[model samples]
Target: MESQQEIKVIKSSGKRAKFSLTKLRSSLKRCGADDHMIDKIVNSVRDELYQGISTKEIYNRAYAMLKKEKHVYASKYKLKKAIYELGPTGFPFEKFVSTILNYSGYKVVLDQQVEGKCVTHEIDVVATKNEKQILVECKFHSEEGRNCDVKIPLYIHSRFQDILLQSTAEETKPQECWVVTNTRFTKDALQYGSCVGLYLLSWDYPINDGLKDRIDRLGLYPITVLSLLSNREKQFLLSRNVVPCRQLIGDQFYLDHLGVSQERQEKIMTEINLLANL
Candidate 1:
């Protein structure tokens, strides 16, 4: 049966878009939901649809059904949401980005101050490998539907230029400056970044080499994505600087810190290892 309803739905950005079945299928598939489950969830979700339905509710319903089928799938489905949980502070997000780069074999430094031509600039992450250095700025948003606008890259690039100038004046190799976000970028932001030679990376930019791609490539799912973990427990792990699920690998001691029962730890470990599968 097809839904007879047609309505503009609200997005996390508060923008309205026509409901898309293809989009629903793609997202469910991307999260490892099979055809049968996707149909069930989509049909269930569509039946609940009304004028001005928020995508958040659609996702919640789909996720609830997905989790009911397989908890691991729920973990995979919440990757974007997990990124959001990385902050009200950008510290954990910077570390999260640094950890991702580190897995790709880069040496990373976090929260360092480097001198620019005009003044000192506090860089979020400094990554070096094979004598090439890259300065990364991480912008984290706690809420969904936020984007890195052109003004962001414009501001960061000016500081990068100043730093680059000073580094060049010192007769040393200069660094590349990059702005990274846990969300998407506006069209103007992408244009400004490319036009200025400032590298920009976000949830799904730069073609196949965006933040989400890298995480999937490395199985570096964050601890926040653990479905069974409470928000308090997740925050506790983040406070201790334990970000990636891989970090807790073979270290049952951290589970001890959370007071997880030995039996519960085993189940949690099972979910953690499932994330590493791809």
Candidate 2:
């Protein structure tokens, strides 16, 4: 059996202890737990320690004890504690994906299950921007010595096929499908998706910068992307003097601009011809 005394002391002091404590504190703060409540939870967990307890066990115990308190702070603390114990690698990758999609002006729907006759597929994140829908499957793995052999591509194809087959006929087909893996894709997988028009967004891409910075500042939580839009896009949509399209149909200047599109020009000319008698 491992010595309890050394383990207990290590859990309570120096760098390892401080790292865990900081992560817990950051999680609580991000989730709106007040300083006093966080301090109380930390002190309470620290006081209940015994020698020889594993760090993993300690985290589980602390989370369970906090849950019994039936307070909002407890729930917030539990969520953060779980994330810290699990490390922000594999399963928590979804948090990063959701944040990035939101930053790119999309609304995310999480963990949607699509059922087939013999199998059911769960999608990690589905997002919509404008009229375009995208299916994103996130895979997080260690940076060093990672192998994506068969599993990554299998999951991506499964989810993509499921979403494509089950969506309603009237609904927009996913304009693009992406396998957003933390590790770079195998050369074979990349070539295959490229040949078939699928997008493989690896962690090496620029999207990672927006994701990492935002998650650090905002913690592992969802954010709205509408606020992140460019100032020009916002300004163009807000200029008050821009007449409504309905009111400008008969205006020659409006017809000239509408003439840029052959289909729209025909429709506008037909409308003008019909409205002339009125």
Candidate 3:
């Protein structure tokens, strides 16, 4: 117990680092868990910590505790993991971003073919607002702890530049290229993206306006975050392009298709309404 302070946890990157109480506490706090609940969860988690434990295990333990307290807290705490649930493919993630941009008042189109200066490129998402057009490239990784490296921005910047050079490109209205991801950006990725003027959004980058910030601010959580839905159920919804919890709120008949019981459906929608009304 005395040596618990020195315990090392394995990250998804296979790197081991000393566990920090501050980091764990901050994450719980972000989920809107108050000091009292935070203290209880933190102490409980600390008591269970052992050397060589993985971060995933720590998160699962904490998430279970949070869920026991409040479904809303647990849902929000699971935001990052829920985003991961968006994909075995990048397409669902792209649709997820398009949905967010749409809620933010942008007209969004997905998987568009645009002619660049040299070759035609398929844009993951093209968002337009008030005559401003933004081309978004989404990078989705199925695994955690994989950060977007400098090479990503470095490579995408060239394609963006080519599109910028297109004389016949549509609208041409103050086009901006954005790179969005569900993970963190490497230091070089951030630097290169900034230096090249490419808009970058990741889990926690850009301080106040990262992907997580945007999601929390908008209360636009993915349906995958719902606690009662099994993985099979979530995948069924995703296959039907039902990504946002708000969207599912309108069309929960998908729940019926899965043969979910009326009682279970009520419980699921209760959780969704809590998030939707957040």
Pairs in steric clash, model 2: 4-52
lDDT of each residue in 172-255, candidate 3, tens digit only: 743799999999899989988889899999988789899888988888899888888899999999999999998878898899
- For model 1, the stretches where C-alpha displacement exceeds 4 angstroms are 1-5, 169-171
lDDT, candidates in the order shown: 0.88, 0.51, 0.90
Residue 162: error of model 2 in Å?
A: 3.5
Per-candidate TM vs. native? 0.94, 0.41, 0.95
Q: Per-residue lDDT for 68-154 in model 2, tens only?
A: 543333434443232222223454456556655775579998787755434677778879988788877777664333535555676
Candidates in descending TM-score order: 3, 1, 2
Best by lDDT: 3
Once superposed on the true structure, which residue ranges of model 2 sit more than 4 Å away at CA? Answer: 1-89, 116-118, 205-278
**What global local distance difference test value does model 3 have?**
0.90
* Candidate 1 whole-model C-alpha lDDT, 0 to 1: 0.88
User: Between prediction 2 and prediction 3, which has the larger TM-score?
Assistant: 3
Q: How well does candidate 2 match the true structure in TM-score terms?
A: 0.41
